[model samples]
Target chain A: MSKLAHMFLLLFAMAGITYLIRMLPLVFFRKKIKSRYIRSLLFYIPYAVLSAMTFPFILYSTGNFSAAIVGTAVALIAAAFRLSLIIVAVLSCAAVFVAVLIL
Target chain B: MEQSPLKFKHGIKDGLPIGLGYLSVAFAFGVQASILGLPALFSTLISMTNLTSAGQLAGITIIAALGSVAEIMLVQLVINSRYFLMGVSLSQKADATFTTGKRFIAAAFITDEIFAVAISKRQAINFKYFIGLAVLPYIGWTIGTVLGAFSGDILPANLQAALGIALYAMFIAIIFPPAVKALNICFTVFSAALLSCACYYIPFIRNNLSEGFAIIICALVSAAVAAAIFPVKEKDNE
Candidate 1:
């Protein structure tokens, strides 16, 4: 198949998966769940997924690896202090921009 | 579910920050997709259909690399599998007013940021509020992608390069607050990092398994460890 056809097929499948993952539970289960294991897993998911997506990867998401490291440190520190998300993001970008300029 | 003007307005109010955040990240996504040789309009369509960052990026990368259809499906499913858990967790908190059709439609917008805000509300969530919550972010993400795709050439290289890191920083902001709140969360993230790092550094895993699968494995290992060793016992629908 051509790339456009490939893209169309892939997107259709993506929509299916995204919809299933999100829709099934919200639609089928109406009442409160009593499973402790499920609850604990859900509670930990945000941190687990976020960390998996953030760390190590953040070290390379920028233009330069060293700049990414510098930006991430600034971001962690800024976020720890309870700065807003936009503020933290901007500051992190600035840290990288400055690092790129200096180095 | 109730059609309260006040609730819809509050949802929009709560969603602005998320929309702004999505704008920057999705803008970067558009630029990144274009740099990879995908058309801008197609990239925007991806954003509109996917509404996810990591999953969509992974998909685009695979497409650019000429991966097979099976690869695309597997990669997206693995990366986006977390949404299943989130949906399950939200099921209990969802308002009774949501009909089947509304639930299906609303679930499409159950993104991380939207979920974070929705679940934290002290009151029952309504369909109108939830729809309102997703509107601005949906608009922002789509518009940002379009702008970046068509006008990305207008931007200087340095700023474009810098914008790439915004998504990672946003993820950091999301995770940091929760990590600081609970020690168990810190442990969970730590374990996840260790697993992800191991997958990246280990010669066999790096080549043998795709990045999408590695993420799933790392997350599952950490979450399973957390659930077993430090199970949190909050009542669902609380």
Candidate 2:
């Protein structure tokens, strides 16, 4: 197959898998999912997901330890102050880029 | 609270800010997809179907890395597992009087931002507002992807780099509100950053892990540690 055709097939399969994961709980667990403990656990999932998503980016800019340290410091300060999302992210990226340049 | 026919109105109102924010991020994804050599139509289609920021980024990265179908599926499953919890949380906020059709529609639109706003209302989520919230963001995401894919071809490389800032900005926005008063949140975020950096520097660990998996591990570990040390007291049922 051509490269385009290959990409199409891969994306199609990926979409199918993604949709199934997202839809399964709503469909299969509709009637079976009635518990308070599970509900409480669900509340924490977003926080967990968000933290996981942000962690790596703040560390290891361009796969370097020093840049990661600088980036982490900047992100922590911005996050602590509750700065705007755009500001913190931009600051972190800039900090990392500058740190890599200097160190 | 008084019942209003403008239920969907509220959703639209709440969704507008989020939708605006989504436009830039989704546009970046579109550009990335195009740069990766995916067709413009395919890029837009992915955005329309998925409507997720991190998931789309992961999907594009995995595809670019030439991961096998099995690997892609596993990644998607793991990355999106959190949605199951979100869906269940949404169910509690939903009205028992709502029909299956309504639930399905609402479930389809249960994004992180939408869920946060809906849950904060502490009322039976109005289907109208839910639909309203979904509408603009959906359109913005689809259109942004298409536009970005097309524009990626013509945009200067420097401009593209600047546009990339939008995604990070959105993350900062989400973290800012929660961290304002909470030192523990700050510490947890910092710790996760440190851990992620260590994982990156360690050749064996870095080679074994994908970004999605790393994110899940870091977030859960940091948050779990923070929750243990700084527990929130719950109100007793009267």
Candidate 3:
């Protein structure tokens, strides 16, 4: 295969695999889960998953420890107030920028 | 399931910040594609099709290295597997109005940010609101990819680096509010954080485990433990 065709082939494979992973459960698993244990577990998955992804990773995300720390602190405070997602994200990014400049 | 008063308009409004965040991250991806001698069109196409950051990066690396088609599929499956869990969770969150066709359409756009926002809704999301929520971020990601491919390094390094934290901050925002009100949720989040830290720090696990698997392990273990300890008496249909 030519280079461009090869790239397209690879892209399609990636897209196909990803779409399958996302699409299957929603399409087939429409019934409400019966078990309280399972339902509660699902409820907690989002928080648990997001939390794991954020910390330690967030510390290294900005490539500067102090900036990331500042950003995280601002995000925690802003989130505690139940601020909108936009505001909290913007505040975090802005805090990281200012921290980067000063430190 | 409680009927959500939210409509397409609310989705658009909620999606704006997510779109803004995607733009910066997609821009970085675009620049990486450009560095690999790929054109702006290709990078934009990848963003349009995949709509994911880490998966796209891994895909392109495999492509550049002349890896096989099987390698592409396997790597993407491993990296993007989190979407499987998210899909299962969101499937339960969707209202009756979220039919087969709507689920099919909405499933294509289930990124981490989009899933987080959708799951955070107090009521079950219907198809219209979910689609409305998805539009802007999709466009923003595509546009950002094109811009990055064409105008590489226009933004200052500090600003771009700062933007890197935007998605994580949004994640924090999503997980924190409910945490304060419920002690169980607080414990779950804290436990997941500790487990994740262990995955990051322990040399054996750090070296052996991929980022994607580490997330799955931490989330599943913490959530299962929490559920066993504090099972909800009734499922909150909200």
Evaluate model 2 with DockQ and give the value.
0.32
- DockQ of every candidate structure: 0.62, 0.32, 0.53
Give the range where candidate 2 chain A is weakest over 10 consecutive residues by summed lDDT. A36-45
Ordered list by lDDT, greatest first: 3, 1, 2
| Candidate 2 residue-wise lDDT, A1-103, digit = tens | 6666666666777677666655555544554344543443333444555555555553422355776677667766776777766567667657766766678
TM-scores across all candidates? 0.87, 0.76, 0.70
RMSD of each: 3.0, 4.5, 5.4
1 against 3, candidate with superior DockQ: 1
lDDT tens per residue, model 3, B1-238:
3354788899999999989888876776776676556778888888998998767866776777656787788667655766776787899888888888888989999998899899998888888889999999999999989997786456667776887777678778888998898998999999999999999999999988766567668888898999999887663522
Q: Which candidate has the highest lDDT of all?
A: 3
Evaluate candidate 1 and give its CAPRI docking class based on DockQ. Answer: medium
Please state the interface RMSD for every predicted structure, separated by commas.
Answer: 2.4, 4.5, 4.4
Misplaced by over 4 Å in model 3 are A1-14, B1-43, B51-103, B109-137, B144-152, B233-238
Candidate 2 positional error at B2, Å: 3.0
Candidate 2 wrong stretches, greater than 4 Å? A1-6, A9-48, A55-83, A86-103, B176-180, B220-238
lDDT per residue for candidate 1 within B1-238, as digits (tens), equals: 3343337888998999889888878887887787677888888988998899877877777777766677777666656766776787677777776888888888889888899898888777878888889999999999989987776666777776677677778778877887788788888988998898988889999999876667767887898898899878574223
> Which ranking of candidates, highest TM-score first?
1, 2, 3
